[model samples]
Target: MTTEVKPSPRERLLEAAATLTYRDGVGIGVEALCKAAGVSKRSMYQLFESKDELLAASLKERSAAFVASLLPPADDGRSARERILHVFEQVQSQAGAPEFRGCRYLAVQIELKDQTHPASRVAHQIKANLTAFFRSEAEQGGASDPDLLARQLILVFDGASARAGIQADDLTGLIAPTVAALLDAADMR
Candidate 1:
């Protein structure tokens, strides 16, 4: 008779890693992650072989979720600017969520010294894709120098993330006006 195994150890590890990485940043150790996931150290090692591999998988999982969350649901019927602004709104909303921490990618970047790590590489790719998305939207909106506009908006985005992470305060007020100014400037040029 074969007994059905419950949730796989790998799944548990990934879930735990995602939660712990988001809540405490990537500085969290493998042991803690295994414990949180309710997996034995041997199980974790069996699945990932090393912390770096586990981290890479965890980062990938988080990146996928983050991008999915950024997508506007059907029926929102919002303009590009509104959608962009909505991203900030979501960030602000996170401030009130239980166990709120800073951007997971940024946290990993800070904790990991090696720029070439798989986790770091994936994080950088995600940022670049976001910037490209903003630039494309700006260009389609007929903004002169869409690249520049995208860069400026990225600054605001990064600033908001950093401020919220560091100060534990919502920077939504600052972001709204600045975004408006950006759109206005884009319109003029």
Candidate 2:
């Protein structure tokens, strides 16, 4: 016999928060969040100190999911450069999903705007972590200027995500070859 333990209240709330944020963006009141999570306001307050804390926790969860999905493969039989470029294909596939709504971190920044906001801080940190991944990959691929290449790659990624989310366009076909050309220009491959 096996016992199935249900998700904790915090897990349920974070899951609900992530889904609602993807569907409706962030900054909804605690009452609304409680309703969405199917937890009571008392439960939410017991789990998180405030709405900002809940939102920040939810953003962190989403960021981890993004990193796990978008990180280049280590031994997937593709060159590091191709693996790096594979991020676009991964993101494009994710964007095409029914519940996609661009990046949730970007959504928080757009909605909050204040640099001091907790959610804004979380968003900035998530972006910095992504940039770091690009930098590391660029270095491993033998780029002469790994830092610069990483910055450029982040720009391309940002643009592709924006276009994919806003214009509903498919960029997978162009991304890999374009990235390969950049690697070639950098004497990487």
Candidate 3:
């Protein structure tokens, strides 16, 4: 016989918040979140200081998996150019999914419209990390201007993700070429 461990209330709330807010936007109410998580309002309050705190904690909890999904494995033996492209490829793959609502971090920041909010701060940090990855890779690839290339790469990423998420573009025949152009302009091999 085997026992299956159930997620604790905190875990369930985090999962619920991450899922619900991504699907419904940051305006999702506490009642809906607690209902989805099967946790009571009182329990939620006990676990988190407020809804904003819960939202930030949920985003923080999922940050590792989010980065893992987008970033290439460490020392994957690929060139910096290839590693950089890998991130876009992952985004393209994810955007193809029906449930894809664009980048959750992007959505949260936009919806909250408050940089000082805990969740917004968390979202900002996550995006900064992505930009840092691009900067590091651009430098390693010997780009003419790593800073410019990194900024351009992240802009492309954000745009592609937003366009695809909104179904405005499938991102097919789009991301790779645009990225290649940017890479070439920067003289990255």
Candidate 4:
């Protein structure tokens, strides 16, 4: 015999927020979030003090998952430049997916830009984490200035994502060569 355990209210709610907030927008009401999660408002309140808290939690969870997916494993047997440029290919593939709706971190920031929101803080931390990833890769690639190289590579990664959201087409062919040049220039290749 086997037993199936349901996901906790917090986990369920975060899953709902991940789908709804990204698909519809963060303007989605608390009621909608609860309904989608198949959870009671009480459950939501029990885990998170408020809807904003849930929003921040959702963003944090989603961004961490996403950045992990974007970069390949360190032992994937590829050079740093190959691994780095692979990110552009990911951006295009994700954007071209039927449900693509821009970067969730950027989406939340746009929704909460004016206010001093915790979601905004989480988004900034996600970007910092990404920059740190790039810095480590640049070091492996043997860049003379790994920090600056990481910053530039991060900008390329960001711009390609923004373009992907708007263009919603495979921009990898256009972006990858430039990144290759960047890697070569920095001795990352």
Clashing pairs in 2: none
- Per-residue lDDT tens digits for candidate 3, residues 1-189, read 999999999999999999999999999999999999999999999999999999999999999999999999999999999999999999999999999989999989999999999999999999999999999999999999999999999899889999998999999999999999999999997
The residue-by-residue lDDT of candidate 1 on 1-189, one tens digit each, is 999888788888988888887777777888899888899999888889688889888778777678767655634777767767777677777755656566777778778877899888877788888788778777766777889988988778777777777775667467678887988888822
Global CA lDDT computed for model 3: 0.96
RMSD values, in order shown: 3.7, 2.0, 0.8, 2.1
Could you tell me how far off, in angstroms, the CA of residue 59 lies in candidate 1 after the best superposition? 1.3
Best by TM-score: 3
Name the runs in model 3 displaced over 4 angstroms.
none
lDDT of 2 by residue, 1-189 (tens): 999999888998998887777677775677778887789998898899988888889888887678888986567777667777678778878877766667777777888878688888998898888888778878888989999888887777776776766756666586677777777877774
Q: In model 1, what lDDT does residue 133 have?
A: 74
Give me the runs in candidate 2 sitting further than 4 Å from their true place.
73-78
TM-score of 4: 0.88
**Residue pairs in collision within model 3:** none
Worst 10 residues of 1 by lDDT: 68-77
Which residues of candidate 1, in runs, are more than 4 Å off? 1-6, 73-77
Please give the RMSD of candidate 1 to the true structure: 3.7
TM-score on alpha carbons, each prediction: 0.86, 0.88, 0.98, 0.88
lDDT of each structure?
0.77, 0.79, 0.96, 0.82
How far is 51's C-alpha from truth in model 4 (Å)?
Answer: 1.1
lDDT of 2: 0.79
Ranking 1 against 2 by TM-score, winner = 2
